[model samples]
Target: MLYKIFAAALAAAFTLLLLPGCKDQAKPSETAEVIYHVCQRSFYDSNGDFNGDLNGLREKLDYLQDLGVTSILLLPLYESVYHHNYFASDFKKIDPEFGTTDDYLALVKDIHSRGMKLYMDMETQYVTQEHIWYKDSYNNPKSKYSNYILYDDSAQTKPSTIVFELNSLKGYDGVEHKITTVNLKNKDVLEYNYELFKYFADPNNDGNFDDGVDGFRLDHAMDTLDLKPRLTGLFKAFWSPLLTRLKQVNPKLNFVAEQADWSSLGIDYLTKANVDRVFNFRLAFAIREFDRDKIMAMADSSFSATPAGKQQVVFIENHDMPRFAQVVKKNAGKEKVGAALNILIGGVPSIYYGQEIGMVNGDKPDNVYGPTDANGIPLREAFEWYSGETGKGMSVWYKDTGPWWTDRNMKPNDGISYEEQKGNKNSLWNFYKTVIALRKNNQAIGLGQYQTLPNSNKQVVSFLRYTHQQAVMVLVNLSATAQKAEVYLSASKVPVNRLGSLMSNKSASAKDRRVTIELPGYGVEVFDVK
Candidate 1:
């Protein structure tokens, strides 16, 4: 761990106190969780079946626990023809390739036993050709399931396309399958979807969640249904009604909406659609930019925009985006800085698998694989579990099947995998552990409200996460060279005791309660003042 804290006598001089108070205290209902987002298909493999399954994830609970993650945000677990599990063929049925109902229930129980939560991604918007809705009503308006799907054509033969007018996609198996968006406008369709989700949240209706998932990630959530005139204001009609009902069953059930527009803050989904959380995509983009002004502006706006009891899920990468490592060109300092922003911020932190060891996208520099394959195949490659590329529990579902495997990201001796860096204290993996531990152990960071502080340096961004009883100050240097940051403390409720730090050099002088400290390029300094 790169963390060292030396507590000194505060009687001499004050050095760690930071900016003052926020008028509104944070709502602590669903805060303090470090979520580890997993594409299970690319994570652990327990059955030697080449595909990462529910049991495979259950087997790695200890690993995740050791990594300090409190929850697992799994990709869509419903039956989908798409490798990434987006276009589901069946919402009620578990994908046979992943496991069965019993496997899912067992995974849920194991997760609960560890005091951990599992959230499954659900994309009820679209369905593949094999889906019961699509199969039963694709070309028949007279079919009983006809209103279950939306069709653009008057004959009801042509189902509405999703995202870019494309109705077919070549999946991980290199097979093209047709897809269509579901009709949420229909009362029956909405009822069916709600029942499907409720069953997963409480399978037995015994009021026990051990046999069910803790929550659901609404993928590509939209109130307007891709700007369709007929589906406008679905938040009040479709989402709020459904989510309100789900919450009645399990008040602790977490719902996060992946808003269709990544550029927006998804605040509507939080307040209108009634989700507990939404991805802080704008902050994620700003972090990757590595500019102080952009990062500060976006981070401040993101945190401030959310309503009470709602939080932004801060993350650097998801299945749809490029890995942060590649975005930073594999720069170690930049990667560490990104880690700091993602974990130390006020919002609930989320970390993608393999991010701890700095895994980049599959280094495929070709266009042989079509558009669908090119988008996420590189970003969602199998987790490099061993020091070398080949090993047991290494999910090689796409190993010998695609050209993407030929030019892979998993290279022997690259020090990117967990096995390669587990023993090295200075490794990225250890750095992530240190930061995660810092967040988990500190009340100010884990459950505190975000408050921006005034700083003298342009290259450095300063802020505080605080509750009534605790406060933690974070000063980050966003430049490429070491810079001096003179920070000022105001009216906030800061501790009156000695200063302790995660800073490498604890040298600083306080005058007027402003401490000047030198931070290396992309260096982050964290202080627990309360």
Candidate 2:
């Protein structure tokens, strides 16, 4: 009778284990991560504010999450007289137009709560005339505030040396190979810059918010010329000590520089300065040649270009340039082909605002340059922030004031509004979304080592990404004609997963270490190698 009672109890426990509400039997795996880009000012209210507040950004977090984005990079938010917010007027204030300091803090808190990372674009090289340091320096160059500027001669331009006007110095007759200036040995300027650094480093001075930011995107760092390498050295010195202080608060902070060019000097600068990443301009310039083989070769050459792999930021356009749509309108297909190449090439891809919607410049000068309307605005005319009737008053980025680029404007409903393409599954928006999503879903593409396929056809470029556990081969058709791809694997019989193709739904099979597949024009295909 006791044995029968014990068996009954055991059977009851077994039944409970098989119940529908039991624990999940599946496990999670550690894989690669992804990041996305969007300008904060791209979203706004109906008041023609031309500023995007954190409150508005919070509402769109779902949109970003749906797109498989893990992080977002924001432009400068500090107070400024200009629209770009680069010429900081006050580092402490949150540009009244954007919102309040409390709002910014709340935004940061919310971002972390959502399990996303937020990076602030730090542009501290220049300040508006209204800055306290500028005002105080102009009033008394010998005062403590005067330490903010490094003066070369103090003779031609008395109070302080203006960086922009350095071209006007004597012997700089507009044709000399180089110009002379005071060595960055200016103790005054060094102390002042360090003080400015301290603000972001420890805004509250309680040593509580030193690492309040996740990463920094340095602006115009290379453009600053010092006769004695003083400026460069000073910048390098700032990083080690400054980063040390920041890491003390948050160890995951990232440091990046916007040097534009990937030269020996630029790479050396980042390495010596202890920066985590440097903008990859070399790749940007090389991709425009419209040769898939060449483009793939460039990616292979730069595998070890710097210390940062997968961490380097790959960008086609930023706030400083016209949307990539405007750039490759004549060769949109080629650029789109390049876009795929960027994804498979590795590194974190950064898309400028309006890239997916095909936003182009209606204003003259095509690229981002030329004049502006009094307030030093970067854009011209009003932009269609969203699509359909929903986006009617969602943005005031261009309507409130004249564009800094006077004759140019981004017209409303010009075939590139968010509404126009959101429903189209075949749209560029979908393409970008899928590519990013694929990166997230695949381990070989995301974290595996990259290897360029040998004997790449001129019109079709192929490469391989492999890890001990898995391998993926990518082949892209660069032209509009249907091209043939011969995929080879080190081992026998692999599964080929065709991506972004309209021709068919079948994935080709490999036999004898080789698989031949038809590739659609300007599309890519990925194969799973076993």
Candidate 3:
């Protein structure tokens, strides 16, 4: 009788789970405040291994927490043939080099225990030739997995027309350079991907919501999966269904896509592909030029173009781009200026690893097509934890591999490491920590509406962020010449007493609801309205 009762109760629970919107409705943590983007292999190494692993990351949680990061967006962690971890051999298995599955679970648990979020980079569009499905389907027409890949049928040689290219492994010799595109429309492939995504969402299956990852960063999220006319709408057809099913299992799971083109803002992804967030690439490109007008204009357009519930992930640099410090020719002041705009702008701020300490990219070969060539070796160099290149916890994955391995921009004891800048008052690392703390502690700055403030100096980009409870003003001088700007705010909007200065690199005062600030070349000031 008890067995029958248990079975009936199980059936009823399963029925309830199948109902639309019947999943547990827990509010997702606010993800927009700040996210730290980490290249896991270069972040920190544990167990005396040169490769940074899940355990290494877990060990460094205190560092991230102290840095005021609310979430971490990691590069791919799945088993891959390449070093950068994009082309996956298996979606379900954690890379052996990174550690076992248990290590990943422990990291996830630690992140949640500390009230932080974890987001993994996922690329379901392609897989390495070594993947089990690819190996089975590559030359065997009779194999059950044969239809899982896209192939050119017109080839004179059987299956020789398989889509193949070097993905981040081009420059290296003796490495497997072939990768197969997954057939997103295939039913078996879809089921495989659905299960993989579901597993990541709730690994323990206990549904306590404390063990699994919170979300994912969809790499190369394009509507046109293959750029061919026939493949153009596959994303809407494929991704939407997969995402819908994933949401049914875990309603709080979120996804951010790296839209194919940086020049265009991806409003289409929000409406068509059903993604939660897209990177603001146009704004990222504009900020590098240090043009106040262009930056503010792009900022306004991005925020305006976004739908009511959607968000834009804003950053000045990432793994696939040149470092912000290098783009500005290692100008500390201009770097700080860029940092100010990144954190103060009204969107989710993502800080690439080593960006807080002003780490710059090393010299690159001339005319390289991508940021760090096909291998992405230089752009994804080891993180500088200390002034000395050789030290405990240092990730020397690409050390002495080639000229790209040299630390050209950062020198030993140059005041750029955590050891060097942790306590320094005016260090770039401190600046980043303070600004992040300011954004987190102040609701007006992190989760409020943004409006550009009027300023006479075109080089000065001033803006106000406010909510019903509070308001704050941000003024940044994007030029090398010292700038004086009279910032005007409505008395009704920001009362006189509440207009006192909060933080500034330069001196400033407020009177009659107006704040006048004099910024030395590339200076920044942030004011709290009460």
**TM-score for each prediction?**
0.92, 0.78, 0.88
lDDT per residue (tens digit) for residues 251-355 in model 2: 566666776333422565455656666666666655655666666666666654545322456666656554566567735565567567666666666666566
lDDT by residue (tens digit), candidate 3, 361-394: 6555422323223336555667788876668888
RMSD of 3: 10.3
TM-score winner, 1 or 2? 1
Which pairs of residues clash in candidate 2, taking residues 3 or more apart in a chain or in different chains? 363-408, 371-404, 372-404, 387-419
The candidate scoring highest on lDDT is 1
Among all candidates shown, the one with the greatest TM-score:
1
Local distance difference test values of all predictions, in order: 0.79, 0.55, 0.75
**TM-score of decoy 2:** 0.78
Off by over 4 Å in 2: 1-33, 46-48, 155-211, 223-232, 260-265, 308-310, 330-335, 366-383, 388-393, 403-409, 487-506, 509-515
TM-score of 3: 0.88
Give the lDDT ranking, best first: 1, 3, 2
Q: Per-residue alpha-carbon lDDT of model 1 for 301-389, expressed as tens digits?
A: 88888887787899988776768998898888888888999999768889999888899985443234644543466778888888898
Error of 2 at 25 (Å): 31
